[model samples]
Target chain A: MPRWEPDAVGRLQAAAIDLFAEQGFERTTVAEIAERAGLTKRTFFNHFADKREALFGPVSERQRELVVAEIAACAGSVSPVDAVLRGLQAAADVMFEERRAAVARRREIIDANPELREREWGKRAALADAIVEALRARGVDSGTALLAAGVGVLVQQMAMRTWAEAADGRPLREHLSDALLSLHAVIGQRSV
Target chain B: MPRWEPDAVGRLQAAAIDLFAEQGFERTTVAEIAERAGLTKRTFFNHFADKREALFGPVSERQRELVVAEIAACAGSVSPVDAVLRGLQAAADVMFEERRAAVARRREIIDANPELREREWGKRAALADAIVEALRARGVDSGTALLAAGVGVLVQQMAMRTWAEAADGRPLREHLSDALLSLHAVIGQRSV
Candidate 1:
């Protein structure tokens, strides 16, 4: 076991993002990331399976857990998509709204690296799966659950894109709500 | 210039799928793929940017173009999402419904290869972009176009999944319609 363990996961993530943005993700090493965080490589490994994991693993997993829990807590009176939107709102309240700059930096880092971008895509897909399971548990059928979950994730993507670009400091919760409305309009239009 | 060039693209793709499945995609070589198709390496290179490109490039691009063109040709009265569904239906009629087994095998090959999986994701994203552009050309705004396009792709994904399962042997166009109804129900339930 390594000795330096001061919020090792957070430290590793921040260091990895900073280093990836600085030296390019492919050129950066796990050892360098660990060293930047002032932790042993063993400590880094303990926190994350690898450098890419450090970038997205913990935070995404945490968000997934929170969203699912929130969805489960919702009553049957709420619509499936609304419950999902509420869960996404709860997730935004917890995981993203407070960490805007850091999340933006992380997105920038991932954008700069093709492998990291793929890993991010994989993480988004995994999160959609979690949302689908949560919706299913709320009595939605399998197919509808999958569709609602996908729409929710798409909303999240649009909100994040806007949030990252807006210098006026609009809150993610507001953006999330806006995205949900956009989704509704998109799906609500009358087919001639 | 290589002499052997009749239906070179199709012959090469069929040859590659056979060899990759028979000898494993990782073990298969471009030279072997070319020889198996009765074509030279120069002919293969002239047709595709690389070996992986042979598997996915032309078909996906053509599919996207076809969908977008079909959507654009629809009467101006069709709703954005409905236009997208029509586009998907048109593509399904031509590109997918006629080629179930081939697509199934291609999906299996992509499933087995991580790089191919990422490429599939990228292709889906590109298709979404194409749909969004077509919607915009029909006077839909950017934000709604993105949302409509994303929802349309979600429908396509749900349809694809249903089509892939052995139990759902219905034509892909039917599945696409079913998916659109499912989307309607999910978004319709919202008490906005």
Candidate 2:
């Protein structure tokens, strides 16, 4: 029973992020976010279950579906790590490529709040679990599936960190690829 | 102003784990844990900051110090992953080899509670940060250092899972070594 608004979700997210940045996440309220976005609390509720969810909810499910589908579609001969990176790259293309500033802002907000950081960790853990299950569906052994998924999550984290900090407008996929190479180089280097 | 009892910390931890496992973590109180250990709540607080820390506090710092020291002592010719695995193996020998049952029980307790799981994740992240710092001190680049430390954590997790589930009573160091080999096999396997 809500009037349709163009880009309600987008407005709500932007408003929420800006308010959180301005007043701090703990002090921000859903009603204030709705007011800032020129929407009702009911409409905000329709879009997100809570303030934290406003920042993270939509992308997790969408990214999970996209990454899992991409993994399923990969050639049978792709290495587990490579398959995971491919899925991650595909997800980056869809979710992160054009959202650099927003992503950086979100990171800063999450970093400033311990509760938000815990939720972010939970989200990352769930993403790794999804990737592990996807790899298992491809007949990967459980142990290797978990390792590859863990590696994939680590790569995504490293790439995201690098992408967020880089002033150059480099694509997230390139950063992801660079992260994978860095991992390989780290794993490959001799102690001497 | 406290009389030191032999193994007071150990007794408190064992009591906390048993109570957490028996009646669930949320319902278990610090006072009850102390009583079960035949110690005062003051004694318990002396050993741990809270009920949750009873399970994780002492070992994390010790393990961090041990692993960092081992990483620092590795031969100059060892690969980063190898050096990390070596450090992990050294720590496992001291802290994990003989504590399989207790460790498994602690994992089960943490796994059952969302808050505990978050704390566990935080502890792990801190450990990874320590490892990254150690690697950087060794002249490894920051990106590669983070990646290697992440892989080290993954290897430790895999080894811990395998060791906790194994009935053979094998040394944890062996499982740590086996996990490293498994990771190599996983990353080395051709997708085709």
Cα deviation of A22, candidate 2, in Å: 4.0
Judging by TM-score against the true structure, name the best candidate. 2
lDDT of each model, Cα atoms only? 0.84, 0.86
| Residue pairs in clash, model 1 | none
lDDT of 2 by residue, B1-192 (tens): 666678998888889999999999999999999899888999988878887798788888889888999999987777677778888888988988878888999889987887787677667777888898988888877887888888888888889999999999889988987887777666655453
lDDT tens readout by residue for model 1, B33-88: 99999988888898888778878868988889889999999999899988999999
Show pairs that collide, candidate 2: A77-B191, A77-B192, A191-B76, A191-B77, A191-B78, A192-B76, A192-B77
Specify the CAPRI tier of model 2: acceptable
| Predictions' DockQ, in order | 0.46, 0.46
Candidate number with greatest lDDT: 2
List fnat per candidate, in order. 0.58, 0.55
What local lDDT does model 1 show for residue B116? 71
